[model samples]
Target chain A: MFLREFWHKLGSPKWFYQISTGWMIGFAVAALVLLVVGMVWGLAFAPADYQQGNSFRIIYVHVPTAMVAQSVYISMGVAGIVLFVWRMKLADVAIAACLPVGMMLTALALFSGGVWGRPTWGTWWEWDGRTVSTLVLLFLYIGIYALREAIPDITLRGRASALVAIVGTINIPIIKYSVDWWHTLHQPGSFSLTEKPTMPVEMWAPLLVMVLGMYCFAGYIILARMRIEILLREQRTQWVRGLVA
Target chain B: MILRLFFSELRLLSRNKAQVLNPLAFLFLGVMLFSVGVPSTVQSNGIYAGAVLWFIVLLTNLLALDGLFRRDYDNGVLEQILCASEIPFMVILMRIFVHWLHTGLLITLLAPLLGLALGIEAHALPVVMLALLLGTPALSFIGATGAALTVGFSRGGVLLALLVLPLFLPVLIFGANVINDAVAGIDNTAQLYWLAFISMVAFTIGPFATTVGLKISVQLQ
Candidate 1:
């Protein structure tokens, strides 16, 4: 019964706004402190790699962003499922809030990956499995964004985008596997995931911190964006007008 | 009922000769332009033929997609069908079938000519044609899903391409590989099997997705 009450309260935008504002502030501070500390430790304190030297330090940013990008997509897929199944407006807002941030993180991952690649592989881009799959993920995000912009109706847009998000989620594994297979067939000596990272704990500890920090940052951004969306969507409501006034 | 719908759809498309002729003409011109644009002497015959033909077929498939629903949509026939039909998926499946018979099947039949123009070996011609025949149904089905999704848009051509083409990549890869393998004197059966598998998957999912998209389109209207 309490869970049901909580679920009912969640459907109320004013309740969500009142509660989420506090969480948002707390998340923002945590993300900021964690990010600053992680960057300082990883950039200044970690020892240089034996192979790629300081150039390998970009992994701290790249891997975390890549992980966050993938996580955001999975979250959107779950939200999509929720939106359609439960008819939840909050889930739609969640998807709307996730796209811009997800696209940015995916782009950052690609850019940082490219920077990491230039020194190690002598090329700015490599058609390996991870790079190709991430590139496809970027395209999927663009497709969703473009589709939403093209549709004018609010409900239809949400439903259509939900369908697309679910489809993209299903395709992610297929895309990853196909690219992996294609890479293996043509390029034998491509990157390997099975080989464990040889980095010392001194190096990886800060990398772990950065990954956690990025995820917290994602949470903060998602909540902040959701609050704004809820306000804009419910602007006609008395509570929203009262808050604005 | 499904067979009748399929035949009527075919007949309706046939009456508008441009619907039948334009995509084929587009394929012919695309093949000519692509072959002329590339310096054909450098690349091997198999590589050039396989890549160019697959891309042209894919583009032709894309071009044919919007027509699947646009006419019925503009005529209000789609709304009528929705209200009248017990199973809209069957109606959608029939439409896709007629579309493939006209555009995709015709492309497969005429692929040999395209192959000859691209200097594909006669031995490899059958493989290319077979690959296309097995592969284009899935292409049509996939395109139907995109068309259904974007049917309500005034300017959906570019958006449909963006939405559909990435999804079409696996089909293109497998389709082209068969002919390339044949050219390399390797057994092409594995590629054909993959093509068949993808086509089966598309057939299962495509009509269902198109039905959902159409229902959404109807709601928006």
Candidate 2:
């Protein structure tokens, strides 16, 4: 009675899809608007680092992508807990949609980081904690995606892959802290929910914008993908056929 | 009953000698090839030496781990183990234990020779071996957890690598760090203890997950 009806509606796929559409379009528009803003600011307006010069521009994309890659996995873990606790099938499907986007963002992080590293660290690769651990996060995302696609039975695959995703969640913090704890070239966190960004407002304001923009884009991409995944996986189900027609 | 059944599974593993040795051979051969291939300059630097050694070890670990719980899934042994055994959990548990004893322990025992080839100092051999002894089991166990989670499907062995290796990172970090520190004549006890703690935690908790995973894998199969 106290917190009931709102949460209850989310249990149904139709309720969720209908409800989420508004959020999806809103996020998509917001992401597009901010992506143009962030890129323009980052590529054109943001001042170059005194140390690394133009290469530091990579941070605008790299850090945000890596950060979102991590948050997406954390979201998937929460989805796992949701499904495991409430047996919400839709939550599992939603979690499935998060995997590839997380992976792509991880790839973006790695690519941008690697390019940034060529100038900063003077090496294409290093076993420095943050670099190596972020690389591992990329693998974990691939594993989640592969596990889902590998199994033929959609529902069963969803459950099994969720189990793997939940287990892999243990590594997220390790990746985050590895940069701080270990002797590494990678920089530490900025703009955390609790902690203030280390840089001045000039740097972090744009960073804050990029982070929010990426979150919204991630939302849009995952929702779009989930709609596709549902259509593909549920092609044989009565509801899906009705929707298709 | 599970012990008897588990031995049969081990026998099934050994019966395919290629399965067991191929990966380990890849480990050895890759190390040998890399050692041969790298310019002497890079090989001389301690930094590159350690990175290359760990990289080879990681790759070999992946190769070996690809076999974890795979054949049994193929043979329907996993399904039988799930349904027929009263202590099916123990059956999954016992298989992983035997796997560690066989693969992890053997690789660890061989780490010194590897250390020697990789230009690791003689004094550091002990630390590297100790790290491997504690660390490889963690890899094997976590790998089995991933293997169990992914066993029934096509393309899963490769996917299993992606899934499990990230989980393998902490041990790699500490294991390599401990070795690097020991070589530098620095105290590495903290890293060593952390690696062991991770191994212990995985050992205690991994079986239950593997058990549930086996059930899920088999049922889906």
Candidate 3:
């Protein structure tokens, strides 16, 4: 019953707007504190890799952004399903809110990956599986962003983008595996659930901090953007007018 | 009903000879351009030929995709069909089938000639044709979804490419690799199976998505 009530409340933009302020502030503070601690520890204090040395520190940013970028796409796909199946207006808003952030994160991940590559791999880019798949993920984000921009109607735009997101989500695994089969030069992932970390505790700990911080950062940004979008989309509603007044 | 839709689509496409011929011409010219531009030393290898042929086929498929629904949508036939047809799914599926028949199948048939011109060995030529035969249906189906989504827009050409091209990657990867493996005598059955699998997935998902896209587009009108 409590879960059902919360679900119904989640459907209300006014309820969401009223309640999310606390979350937005909490996430913002957590993000700033965690990011500062992670960056300082990882960048300045953490011992460098024996092989790549300082160059490997880029992982502090690269791994987290790449991880979050893919996660954001999956979340958007989930939001797309919610929007389609339940006709949740907030779900569409979540998708719209997630796009620019997801795109930027994907771009950042790619850029950071490239920067890391130049030092370690001795080239700025390689057509390896992970790199190409990440690049494709970026393209998927941009395509959805462009699709949303092209459609003028809000309802149609939401549905169309939702469909594309769902399709992309289905394709993502196929793309990753196919590309992996085609070629692979990038190293196997450093972190996995089944295996222990190859790196020492000092290295993985700050990395963990960075990853958590990035998620908090994303949550904060997405929530803030969703709030602004809700206001713009619901400007004519009495609650919105009341809030504005 | 399916046969009727198929024949009418065939008749309609037969009347527009250019619609049937343009992608073929584009495919031919695209191969020709690649052959002219690349050095002979590079073009001599089967890997290069396989990659070039698959790339051109992908482009040719994209070239034909916009026409998949735009004409019908513009003429109000799409609206009428959606409103009146008992099975719009079959109608849409038939339209995509006819589209694949004209564009993808023609390209597959023409690939051998293009493969030879690009210097694929006689032995590898069959694999080129076979891989394209397995692969192009997926391209047509997936591209049809993008085309359906953007059918309402007048200047959807570039946007359509951006939307559809990334989705084409797996088909392009596996399709090209099949030919490369065949050329190298690597027993390419694995890649062929992958191509077939991707095509099946696309076939299952493509029409349903395209139907939804068409509905959303038609309602916009």
Q: Among these predicted structures, which one has the highest lDDT?
A: 3
Top-down DockQ ranking: 3, 1, 2
- Whichever of 1 and 3 has more TM-score, that candidate is 3
Tens-digit lDDT track of model 3 for A1-245: 99999988999999999999999999999999999999999999999999999998999999999999999999999999999898999999999999999999999999999999999999999888999999999999999999999888999999999999988999999999999989898777878999999889999999999999999999999999999999999999999999968
> Which candidate ranks first by TM-score, i.e. highest?
3
**What is the per-residue lDDT of model 2 for residues A1-245, given as tens digits with 9 covering 90 to 100?**
65688668877676666677798899999999988898888888887878889888888898889889888988898887777778887777788789889889988888888888899999877767777767888777777777777777766777777777777775566544543456777676666678877777767777778988999999999998887766675678777667658
lDDT of each: 0.84, 0.77, 0.91
Better of 1 and 2 by DockQ: 1
All candidates: DockQ: 0.53, 0.47, 0.79
Candidate scoring better on DockQ of 2 and 3:
3
Query: Residue B211 CA error for candidate 2 (Å)?
Result: 2.4
List native contact recovery per candidate, as a fraction of 1: 0.31, 0.57, 0.71
lDDT of 1 by residue, B42-157 (tens): 67455768878999999988988878899889888898888898888888899899889888899999988999988788888888889999999888987888899899887889
Error of 1 at B3 (Å): 2.5
Clashing pairs in 2: none
Error of 2 at A93 (Å): 2.0
Sort by lDDT, best first.
Answer: 3, 1, 2
